[model samples]
Target: MIRIVLADDQAVVRDGLSMLLGAADDLDVVATASDGSAAVDAVVRWTPDVALVDLRMPGLDGAQVTAEVGRQAPDVRVLILTTYADDDAVLPALRAGAAGYLTKDTTGEALCSAIRTVAAGGSVLDAAVQQRLVALVGPPVPAPEPDIPDGLTTREVDTLRLVAQGLSNQQVATRLVVSEATVKTHVNHLISKLAVDGRPALVAWAWRHGVVH
Candidate 1:
Protein backbone atom coordinates (compact mmCIF):
# COMPACT_ATOMS: atom_id res chain seq x y z
CA MET A 1 0.00 0.00 0.00
CA ILE A 2 1.12 3.60 -0.66
CA ARG A 3 0.81 5.46 2.64
CA ILE A 4 -0.03 9.17 2.48
CA VAL A 5 -0.46 12.13 4.80
CA LEU A 6 -3.02 14.62 3.51
CA ALA A 7 -2.60 18.26 4.56
CA ASP A 8 -4.86 21.19 3.83
CA ASP A 9 -6.16 24.12 5.89
CA GLN A 10 -9.76 23.64 4.94
CA ALA A 11 -11.65 20.95 6.78
CA VAL A 12 -13.83 20.21 3.78
CA VAL A 13 -10.81 19.80 1.55
CA ARG A 14 -9.09 17.58 4.03
CA ASP A 15 -12.15 15.38 4.43
CA GLY A 16 -12.80 15.23 0.72
CA LEU A 17 -9.20 14.24 -0.04
CA SER A 18 -9.31 11.67 2.72
CA MET A 19 -12.38 10.00 1.22
CA LEU A 20 -11.05 10.18 -2.33
CA LEU A 21 -7.68 8.71 -1.39
CA GLY A 22 -9.19 6.16 1.00
CA ALA A 23 -11.32 4.76 -1.80
CA ALA A 24 -8.25 3.62 -3.70
CA ASP A 25 -7.37 0.08 -2.73
CA ASP A 26 -3.65 0.72 -3.14
CA LEU A 27 -3.69 4.00 -1.19
CA ASP A 28 -4.10 4.65 2.51
CA VAL A 29 -4.64 8.05 4.10
CA VAL A 30 -2.52 7.33 7.13
CA ALA A 31 -2.98 10.81 8.60
CA THR A 32 -4.45 14.24 7.90
CA ALA A 33 -3.47 17.76 9.02
CA SER A 34 -5.42 21.01 8.90
CA ASP A 35 -2.34 23.23 8.95
CA GLY A 36 1.23 23.24 7.73
CA SER A 37 2.95 22.70 11.07
CA ALA A 38 0.64 19.85 11.87
CA ALA A 39 1.26 18.49 8.41
CA VAL A 40 5.00 18.42 8.96
CA ASP A 41 4.50 16.91 12.37
CA ALA A 42 2.31 14.16 10.95
CA VAL A 43 4.85 13.46 8.24
CA VAL A 44 7.73 13.26 10.71
CA ARG A 45 5.66 11.15 12.99
CA TRP A 46 4.32 8.75 10.40
CA THR A 47 7.12 8.86 7.82
CA PRO A 48 4.57 8.03 5.18
CA ASP A 49 5.52 7.20 1.63
CA VAL A 50 4.09 10.46 0.34
CA ALA A 51 2.92 13.77 1.83
CA LEU A 52 0.06 15.38 -0.10
CA VAL A 53 0.44 19.05 0.89
CA ASP A 54 -1.42 22.23 0.15
CA LEU A 55 0.42 25.29 -1.14
CA ARG A 56 -0.64 27.79 1.52
CA MET A 57 -1.15 26.99 5.18
CA PRO A 58 -1.01 28.81 8.52
CA GLY A 59 2.47 27.92 9.78
CA LEU A 60 5.00 26.59 7.23
CA ASP A 61 3.43 26.49 3.77
CA GLY A 62 3.88 23.67 1.29
CA ALA A 63 7.35 24.64 0.07
CA GLN A 64 8.67 25.09 3.56
CA VAL A 65 7.17 21.77 4.62
CA THR A 66 8.70 20.10 1.58
CA ALA A 67 12.14 21.42 2.50
CA GLU A 68 11.71 20.40 6.12
CA VAL A 69 10.52 16.92 5.17
CA GLY A 70 13.50 16.54 2.88
CA ARG A 71 15.83 17.58 5.70
CA GLN A 72 14.17 15.55 8.42
CA ALA A 73 12.97 12.46 6.57
CA PRO A 74 14.64 12.14 3.25
CA ASP A 75 12.87 8.89 2.42
CA VAL A 76 9.42 10.43 2.33
CA ARG A 77 8.37 12.14 -0.91
CA VAL A 78 6.27 15.30 -1.09
CA LEU A 79 3.47 15.98 -3.57
CA ILE A 80 1.86 19.43 -3.70
CA LEU A 81 -1.94 19.30 -3.99
CA THR A 82 -3.11 22.87 -3.93
CA THR A 83 -5.48 25.29 -5.64
CA TYR A 84 -2.67 27.57 -6.70
CA ALA A 85 -0.60 26.79 -9.82
CA ASP A 86 0.99 30.18 -10.43
CA ASP A 87 4.73 30.65 -10.93
CA ASP A 88 5.23 31.96 -7.40
CA ALA A 89 3.45 28.94 -5.91
CA VAL A 90 4.78 26.16 -8.15
CA LEU A 91 8.49 27.01 -8.48
CA PRO A 92 9.43 27.11 -4.80
CA ALA A 93 7.75 23.81 -3.96
CA LEU A 94 9.47 22.15 -6.93
CA ARG A 95 12.85 23.64 -6.01
CA ALA A 96 12.30 22.52 -2.44
CA GLY A 97 12.16 18.87 -3.59
CA ALA A 98 8.48 18.25 -4.18
CA ALA A 99 8.21 15.04 -6.21
CA GLY A 100 4.84 15.91 -7.71
CA TYR A 101 2.44 18.86 -8.18
CA LEU A 102 -1.28 18.84 -8.85
CA THR A 103 -4.09 21.33 -8.54
CA LYS A 104 -7.13 20.56 -6.42
CA ASP A 105 -9.19 20.30 -9.61
CA THR A 106 -7.33 17.14 -10.60
CA THR A 107 -9.56 14.09 -10.87
CA GLY A 108 -9.50 11.63 -7.99
CA GLU A 109 -7.98 8.95 -10.21
CA ALA A 110 -5.27 11.28 -11.43
CA LEU A 111 -4.42 12.36 -7.91
CA CYS A 112 -4.17 8.75 -6.81
CA SER A 113 -2.01 7.93 -9.80
CA ALA A 114 0.26 10.87 -9.07
CA ILE A 115 0.61 9.76 -5.48
CA ARG A 116 1.64 6.31 -6.63
CA THR A 117 4.09 7.81 -9.09
CA VAL A 118 5.69 9.96 -6.41
CA ALA A 119 5.86 7.04 -4.00
CA ALA A 120 7.70 5.09 -6.67
CA GLY A 121 10.40 7.79 -6.87
CA GLY A 122 9.09 9.49 -9.98
CA SER A 123 7.99 13.06 -10.67
CA VAL A 124 4.61 14.36 -11.80
CA LEU A 125 3.36 17.84 -12.69
CA ASP A 126 -0.19 18.91 -13.42
CA ALA A 127 -0.80 20.17 -16.94
CA ALA A 128 -1.21 23.75 -15.68
CA VAL A 129 1.95 23.48 -13.62
CA GLN A 130 3.84 22.13 -16.63
CA GLN A 131 2.62 25.02 -18.74
CA ARG A 132 3.74 27.51 -16.13
CA LEU A 133 7.20 25.98 -16.06
CA VAL A 134 7.39 26.09 -19.84
CA ALA A 135 6.39 29.75 -19.81
CA LEU A 136 9.08 30.48 -17.23
CA VAL A 137 11.70 28.98 -19.56
CA GLY A 138 10.13 31.07 -22.33
CA PRO A 139 9.61 30.03 -25.93
CA PRO A 140 12.59 28.95 -28.00
CA VAL A 141 13.90 31.78 -30.12
CA PRO A 142 13.26 30.99 -33.76
CA ALA A 143 16.44 31.10 -35.83
CA PRO A 144 15.98 32.09 -39.45
CA GLU A 145 16.54 29.35 -42.01
CA PRO A 146 20.18 29.08 -43.31
CA ASP A 147 21.14 30.91 -40.06
CA ILE A 148 20.46 27.62 -38.31
CA PRO A 149 23.80 25.97 -38.84
CA ASP A 150 24.45 22.24 -38.45
CA GLY A 151 20.71 21.47 -38.44
CA LEU A 152 20.49 21.79 -34.67
CA THR A 153 17.06 21.77 -33.05
CA THR A 154 15.57 24.93 -31.59
CA ARG A 155 16.31 23.67 -28.08
CA GLU A 156 19.86 22.80 -29.13
CA VAL A 157 20.27 26.26 -30.58
CA ASP A 158 19.09 27.73 -27.33
CA THR A 159 21.55 25.53 -25.45
CA LEU A 160 24.34 26.52 -27.81
CA ARG A 161 23.65 30.21 -27.41
CA LEU A 162 23.65 29.92 -23.63
CA VAL A 163 26.84 27.87 -23.73
CA ALA A 164 28.49 30.35 -26.07
CA GLN A 165 27.55 33.10 -23.63
CA GLY A 166 29.67 31.29 -21.02
CA LEU A 167 26.92 29.50 -19.09
CA SER A 168 28.03 26.32 -17.29
CA ASN A 169 26.03 23.12 -17.66
CA GLN A 170 24.39 23.61 -14.28
CA GLN A 171 23.70 27.24 -15.05
CA VAL A 172 22.21 26.32 -18.40
CA ALA A 173 20.05 23.74 -16.67
CA THR A 174 18.81 26.35 -14.22
CA ARG A 175 18.05 28.81 -17.01
CA LEU A 176 16.24 26.18 -19.03
CA VAL A 177 14.50 24.63 -15.99
CA VAL A 178 15.88 21.20 -16.90
CA SER A 179 18.41 18.77 -15.50
CA GLU A 180 22.20 19.16 -15.72
CA ALA A 181 22.33 15.74 -17.36
CA THR A 182 20.02 17.05 -20.09
CA VAL A 183 22.23 20.08 -20.61
CA LYS A 184 25.28 17.82 -20.90
CA THR A 185 23.50 15.70 -23.50
CA HIS A 186 22.76 18.81 -25.55
CA VAL A 187 26.39 19.95 -25.29
CA ASN A 188 27.68 16.56 -26.39
CA HIS A 189 25.33 16.53 -29.36
CA LEU A 190 26.41 20.05 -30.27
CA ILE A 191 30.09 19.07 -30.19
CA SER A 192 29.56 15.99 -32.36
CA LYS A 193 27.36 17.78 -34.89
CA LEU A 194 29.62 20.82 -35.15
CA ALA A 195 32.92 18.84 -35.09
CA VAL A 196 34.10 20.79 -32.06
CA ASP A 197 36.61 19.28 -29.62
CA GLY A 198 35.07 20.74 -26.43
CA ARG A 199 33.44 23.77 -24.85
CA PRO A 200 36.15 26.20 -25.90
CA ALA A 201 36.02 24.90 -29.46
CA LEU A 202 32.23 25.04 -29.34
CA VAL A 203 32.37 28.64 -28.24
CA ALA A 204 34.82 29.47 -31.01
CA TRP A 205 32.68 27.69 -33.57
CA ALA A 206 29.54 29.47 -32.39
CA TRP A 207 31.21 32.88 -32.63
CA ARG A 208 32.73 32.16 -36.03
CA HIS A 209 29.39 31.02 -37.38
CA GLY A 210 27.57 34.06 -35.91
CA VAL A 211 25.37 31.80 -33.78
CA VAL A 212 25.94 34.01 -30.76
CA HIS A 213 26.79 37.66 -31.57
Candidate 2:
Protein backbone atom coordinates (compact mmCIF):
# COMPACT_ATOMS: atom_id res chain seq x y z
CA MET A 1 0.00 0.00 0.00
CA ILE A 2 1.04 3.63 -0.61
CA ARG A 3 1.00 5.35 2.74
CA ILE A 4 -0.15 8.99 2.68
CA VAL A 5 -0.29 12.00 5.00
CA LEU A 6 -3.13 14.34 4.03
CA ALA A 7 -2.95 18.03 4.99
CA ASP A 8 -5.74 20.52 4.41
CA ASP A 9 -6.94 23.33 6.66
CA GLN A 10 -10.57 22.76 5.91
CA ALA A 11 -12.10 20.04 8.03
CA VAL A 12 -14.59 19.14 5.33
CA VAL A 13 -11.88 18.82 2.71
CA ARG A 14 -9.74 16.71 5.00
CA ASP A 15 -12.64 14.40 5.77
CA GLY A 16 -13.65 14.13 2.10
CA LEU A 17 -10.12 13.33 1.02
CA SER A 18 -9.69 10.84 3.84
CA MET A 19 -12.80 8.99 2.66
CA LEU A 20 -11.82 9.22 -0.96
CA LEU A 21 -8.33 7.90 -0.36
CA GLY A 22 -9.59 5.27 2.09
CA ALA A 23 -11.66 3.74 -0.73
CA ALA A 24 -8.51 2.81 -2.67
CA ASP A 25 -7.19 -0.61 -1.72
CA ASP A 26 -3.64 0.38 -2.48
CA LEU A 27 -3.87 3.65 -0.58
CA ASP A 28 -4.00 4.32 3.13
CA VAL A 29 -4.31 7.68 4.91
CA VAL A 30 -1.81 7.14 7.65
CA ALA A 31 -2.30 10.60 9.06
CA THR A 32 -4.09 13.96 8.51
CA ALA A 33 -3.22 17.53 9.55
CA SER A 34 -5.20 20.76 9.57
CA ASP A 35 -2.30 23.18 9.12
CA GLY A 36 1.07 23.38 7.45
CA SER A 37 3.17 22.92 10.56
CA ALA A 38 1.11 19.99 11.69
CA ALA A 39 1.38 18.56 8.20
CA VAL A 40 5.16 18.73 8.36
CA ASP A 41 5.09 17.15 11.79
CA ALA A 42 2.88 14.35 10.58
CA VAL A 43 5.11 13.68 7.60
CA VAL A 44 8.22 13.61 9.78
CA ARG A 45 6.56 11.46 12.40
CA TRP A 46 4.96 8.93 10.05
CA THR A 47 7.34 9.10 7.08
CA PRO A 48 4.50 8.38 4.68
CA ASP A 49 5.29 7.79 1.06
CA VAL A 50 3.35 10.86 -0.04
CA ALA A 51 2.11 14.05 1.61
CA LEU A 52 -1.03 15.50 0.04
CA VAL A 53 -0.77 19.18 1.00
CA ASP A 54 -2.94 22.22 0.54
CA LEU A 55 -1.56 25.40 -1.04
CA ARG A 56 -2.67 27.70 1.72
CA MET A 57 -2.73 26.95 5.40
CA PRO A 58 -1.87 28.62 8.68
CA GLY A 59 1.70 28.39 10.06
CA LEU A 60 3.76 27.36 7.01
CA ASP A 61 1.61 27.00 3.87
CA GLY A 62 2.10 24.25 1.31
CA ALA A 63 5.46 25.34 -0.09
CA GLN A 64 6.93 25.72 3.38
CA VAL A 65 5.63 22.33 4.38
CA THR A 66 7.11 20.77 1.27
CA ALA A 67 10.50 22.28 2.03
CA GLU A 68 10.32 21.15 5.61
CA VAL A 69 9.38 17.63 4.65
CA GLY A 70 12.23 17.54 2.17
CA ARG A 71 14.59 18.59 4.93
CA GLN A 72 13.16 16.42 7.72
CA ALA A 73 11.99 13.39 5.77
CA PRO A 74 13.69 13.30 2.45
CA ASP A 75 12.01 10.04 1.49
CA VAL A 76 8.54 11.58 1.58
CA ARG A 77 7.12 12.95 -1.66
CA VAL A 78 5.04 16.09 -1.48
CA LEU A 79 1.96 16.44 -3.68
CA ILE A 80 0.19 19.77 -3.66
CA LEU A 81 -3.61 19.44 -3.71
CA THR A 82 -5.07 22.90 -3.75
CA THR A 83 -7.89 24.98 -5.18
CA TYR A 84 -5.46 27.51 -6.65
CA ALA A 85 -3.53 26.74 -9.84
CA ASP A 86 -2.14 30.20 -10.46
CA ASP A 87 1.55 30.79 -11.07
CA ASP A 88 2.08 32.26 -7.63
CA ALA A 89 0.86 29.06 -5.99
CA VAL A 90 2.20 26.41 -8.36
CA LEU A 91 5.72 27.68 -8.92
CA PRO A 92 6.78 27.90 -5.29
CA ALA A 93 5.55 24.43 -4.37
CA LEU A 94 7.43 22.97 -7.32
CA ARG A 95 10.55 24.94 -6.48
CA ALA A 96 10.36 23.73 -2.92
CA GLY A 97 10.52 20.05 -3.95
CA ALA A 98 6.94 19.03 -4.50
CA ALA A 99 6.75 15.99 -6.75
CA GLY A 100 3.21 16.67 -7.95
CA TYR A 101 0.62 19.42 -8.22
CA LEU A 102 -3.14 18.83 -8.50
CA THR A 103 -6.05 21.13 -7.91
CA LYS A 104 -8.84 20.06 -5.63
CA ASP A 105 -11.08 19.74 -8.67
CA THR A 106 -9.19 16.60 -9.66
CA THR A 107 -11.26 13.45 -9.60
CA GLY A 108 -10.66 11.10 -6.72
CA GLU A 109 -9.29 8.46 -9.08
CA ALA A 110 -6.83 10.93 -10.57
CA LEU A 111 -5.79 12.10 -7.10
CA CYS A 112 -5.09 8.55 -6.02
CA SER A 113 -3.21 7.87 -9.22
CA ALA A 114 -1.11 11.01 -8.70
CA ILE A 115 -0.27 9.88 -5.18
CA ARG A 116 0.82 6.52 -6.52
CA THR A 117 2.87 8.13 -9.25
CA VAL A 118 4.64 10.43 -6.77
CA ALA A 119 5.24 7.55 -4.43
CA ALA A 120 6.78 5.65 -7.31
CA GLY A 121 9.23 8.53 -7.90
CA GLY A 122 7.35 10.05 -10.82
CA SER A 123 6.05 13.58 -11.21
CA VAL A 124 2.43 14.54 -11.82
CA LEU A 125 1.11 17.92 -12.96
CA ASP A 126 -2.62 18.37 -13.34
CA ALA A 127 -3.67 19.24 -16.90
CA ALA A 128 -4.93 22.65 -15.84
CA VAL A 129 -1.79 23.30 -13.82
CA GLN A 130 0.35 22.29 -16.78
CA GLN A 131 -1.47 24.76 -18.98
CA ARG A 132 -0.95 27.50 -16.46
CA LEU A 133 2.77 26.71 -16.30
CA VAL A 134 3.04 26.66 -20.09
CA ALA A 135 1.30 29.98 -20.38
CA LEU A 136 3.51 31.44 -17.70
CA VAL A 137 6.64 30.25 -19.46
CA GLY A 138 5.26 31.30 -22.89
CA PRO A 139 5.93 29.59 -26.20
CA PRO A 140 9.43 28.64 -27.19
CA VAL A 141 11.54 31.10 -29.14
CA PRO A 142 14.49 29.39 -30.72
CA ALA A 143 17.96 30.85 -30.44
CA PRO A 144 19.56 32.35 -33.55
CA GLU A 145 21.96 29.43 -34.04
CA PRO A 146 21.00 27.11 -36.90
CA ASP A 147 22.76 23.91 -35.78
CA ILE A 148 20.82 21.74 -33.29
CA PRO A 149 22.47 20.10 -30.31
CA ASP A 150 22.84 16.28 -29.96
CA GLY A 151 22.15 15.73 -33.68
CA LEU A 152 18.42 16.00 -32.94
CA THR A 153 16.11 15.85 -35.91
CA THR A 154 13.96 18.91 -36.63
CA ARG A 155 10.88 16.96 -35.47
CA GLU A 156 12.57 15.89 -32.26
CA VAL A 157 13.54 19.48 -31.63
CA ASP A 158 9.93 20.50 -32.15
CA THR A 159 8.79 17.83 -29.71
CA LEU A 160 11.35 18.93 -27.14
CA ARG A 161 10.23 22.53 -27.44
CA LEU A 162 6.59 21.67 -26.87
CA VAL A 163 7.36 19.30 -24.04
CA ALA A 164 9.48 22.00 -22.42
CA GLN A 165 6.53 24.33 -22.74
CA GLY A 166 4.66 21.88 -20.46
CA LEU A 167 2.27 20.61 -23.12
CA SER A 168 0.96 17.10 -22.63
CA ASN A 169 1.68 14.56 -25.34
CA GLN A 170 -1.86 14.84 -26.69
CA GLN A 171 -1.70 18.62 -26.68
CA VAL A 172 1.64 18.53 -28.43
CA ALA A 173 0.21 16.14 -31.00
CA THR A 174 -2.71 18.46 -31.66
CA ARG A 175 -0.41 21.45 -31.96
CA LEU A 176 1.92 19.62 -34.36
CA VAL A 177 -0.96 18.11 -36.33
CA VAL A 178 0.31 14.60 -35.69
CA SER A 179 -1.09 11.52 -34.01
CA GLU A 180 -0.65 11.14 -30.28
CA ALA A 181 1.30 7.94 -30.81
CA THR A 182 3.59 9.79 -33.18
CA VAL A 183 4.15 12.47 -30.58
CA LYS A 184 4.96 9.85 -27.98
CA THR A 185 7.45 8.32 -30.39
CA HIS A 186 9.08 11.69 -30.87
CA VAL A 187 9.19 12.19 -27.12
CA ASN A 188 10.82 8.84 -26.59
CA HIS A 189 13.40 9.73 -29.20
CA LEU A 190 14.05 13.07 -27.49
CA ILE A 191 14.42 11.37 -24.12
CA SER A 192 17.00 8.96 -25.54
CA LYS A 193 18.93 11.57 -27.49
CA LEU A 194 18.94 14.16 -24.70
CA ALA A 195 19.78 11.62 -21.99
CA VAL A 196 16.99 12.80 -19.76
CA ASP A 197 15.14 10.50 -17.39
CA GLY A 198 11.58 11.66 -18.10
CA ARG A 199 9.35 14.52 -19.15
CA PRO A 200 10.17 16.69 -16.11
CA ALA A 201 13.88 16.27 -16.71
CA LEU A 202 13.29 16.99 -20.37
CA VAL A 203 11.75 20.33 -19.46
CA ALA A 204 14.70 21.20 -17.24
CA TRP A 205 17.14 20.13 -19.91
CA ALA A 206 15.38 22.18 -22.54
CA TRP A 207 15.62 25.30 -20.39
CA ARG A 208 19.22 24.59 -19.41
CA HIS A 209 20.26 24.03 -23.04
CA GLY A 210 18.27 26.91 -24.49
CA VAL A 211 16.04 24.53 -26.46
CA VAL A 212 13.19 26.66 -25.23
CA HIS A 213 13.35 30.29 -24.25
All candidates' lDDT scores?
A: 0.81, 0.82
In terms of lDDT, the poorest run of 10 residues in model 2 is 139-148
Clashing pairs in 2: none
lDDT of 2 by residue, 1-213 (tens): 999999999999999999999999999999999999999999999999999999999999899999899899999999998786774867778878888889988888888878887797656887677656655555544567523575788888988888777666767889999998898888888878877655655676676556666
Model 1 lDDT per residue over 3-37, tens place: 99999999999999899889889999999998889
Q: What does the lDDT read for residue 194 in candidate 1?
A: 83
Relative to the unseen true structure, what is the C-alpha lDDT of residue 182 in candidate 1, on a scale of 0 to 100?
92
Which candidate comes out best when scored by lDDT? 2
Off by over 4 Å in 2: 142-213
Residue 161, candidate 1: how far off, in angstroms? 19
